[model samples]
Target: MNEFQRISPQQAQALRQQGAVIVDIRDPQSFAAGHIQGSRHLDNHSLHDFIRNADLDAPLIVSCYHGNSSQGAAAYLVGQGFSQVYSLDGGFELWRATYPDDTAQSPAE
Candidate 1:
C-alpha cells in the first residue's frame, strides 16, 4: 500500500480521539509559531534521524504548510515499515480553517 492516504480535518479529529500522533514537519521555528494541538515537531529532511530517535509504534499524522511534504513523509514512513501513518489533507492551513481552538501558535517562532 504505497499509495498516499489523506485524512480530512474531520477524520483527523476522530483519529485524534483514539490517540493518533500528529507530526508537524515544519522546522522548529515554524513549528513553534503554530501547529495542530499536541503535534510533535519533526523536520522532513531529518525524517530517518528523528524517527530513529523517537518512538515508532505510534500512528503518525504527518503535516506541512499545504499538504505536500507531509504526504511525502507518510509515504516514506510507510515504506520504512510504519504500519499506521497518515497525512492531513490541505495541511495546517485547512486544519486551522476547520479548528481554531484546537490549534495554537507558538510565541517564539
Candidate 2:
C-alpha cells in the first residue's frame, strides 16, 4: 500500500505468529535490555543491510519505545518497497506490558 497501518499489541502478536518480520528501532541499549522476542534491531548501521536482504513483499512490523516513532519507521519501510507494513501501536512498552512472557533480553539469535 501507499502507507503503513497502525496495529495494537494484540494485532502485532498475531502478525508475529504469521511470520511477519518485526524490527525494533529503539536504541541498542534499550533494545538489549528488553524487546519482543524474535525481533531484529534496526538502526542506521543495519538498516541498509536489512532492507537489501529483506523480502520486499513480506509483512513488516516496525516498533519503537512508544507507538509514535514506529509509524514513521513503518512508512519508511513501505517507501523502501515493503508491501505489508505495520507500526506497532503503543510500541515496545505496550507490547511488554501486554505480553510480559513474550519478551527477550539481549537480542535475538
Q: How many clashes does each candidate structure show, in the order listed?
A: 1, 0
lDDT of 1 by residue, 18-91 (tens): 88888888778777878999887786476668678756666678889888888888898887877688899999
Give the per-residue lDDT of model 2 (tens digit) for 1-109.
Answer: 8799999999989988999989999999999999999999999999999999999988889999999999988988888999899999999999999999999999355
For each candidate, what TM-score against the reference?
0.84, 0.96
Q: Highest lDDT: give the candidate number.
A: 2
Q: Which runs in model 2 stand beyond 4 Å of their true positions? A: 107-109
Against the unseen true structure, what C-alpha lDDT does each candidate score? 0.82, 0.93
Cα-based lDDT at residue 107, candidate 1? 71
Error of 2 at 30 (Å): 0.1
- Candidate 1 clashes between residue pairs 3 or more apart in a chain or in different chains: 33-106
